[model samples]
Target: MTEFSSILSTSNIRGAYKSSQELTTSPVAPEPQGTGESFADVLRNAAQSTVETTRQAEAVAQQGLTGKVGAQQVVEATLELESTVKVMISMRDKVVEAYQEIIRMPI
Candidate 1:
């Protein structure tokens, strides 16, 4: 569906290509042949999401402090930050451990 070249080969076309009825689906989606998103794109998206989450968390904390937000809002924000931080830290720890383990092993 992403590219006509991928779905209907340039050489020939028999009938309408139905994505669902196909006997099997591809693990990788076909692109327009050249376009690609690098690893940096994914990291950028994730960083942006984290920034937005942090902003919302801060807003909730500020509102609660100013008595504009309820206790629930404050609690929810705290929990969100706690959970996000926990996941990030765990990921970081795993990456670091993997790197260290790799360094200790002979090539």
Candidate 2:
């Protein structure tokens, strides 16, 4: 019984040591893949979308003025343009804030 207990304890210690070694030598978290569009691409897309929305709103307004479109269509386009402008403004403010924060960081 003493011999068996000694062997068991030794095996347990060996297993624990092996696990600690594995933990220390394991690879770190993987780097993010370059599979997605970049920040500049995202900003460019957003700007394009905003411009398109504004153009659509203007077209709808012109159509309404010419008696070709209904008031509902114009109102919807205007609302969409308003929301897009608001979002763009908010994004700009955030980017500016981030830039300021970065600039204020100690070198």
Query: Best candidate, TM-score-wise?
Result: 2
Over 1-107, each residue of candidate 2 has an lDDT whose tens digit, in order, gives: 34534333454445444533432232355537775555677677777877877898899999999999987667666665666777778778888999999999999
Clash count for candidate 2 is 0
Count of clashes, each model: 0, 0
Q: What is the C-alpha lDDT of each candidate?
A: 0.56, 0.67
Which lDDT value does model 1 have at 92? 56
TM-score, one value per model: 0.56, 0.70
Where does candidate 2 clash, by residue pair? Answer: none
Question: Which residue runs of candidate 1 sit more than 4 Å off their true CA positions?
Answer: 1-45
Name the best candidate (by lDDT).
2
Clashing pairs in 1: none
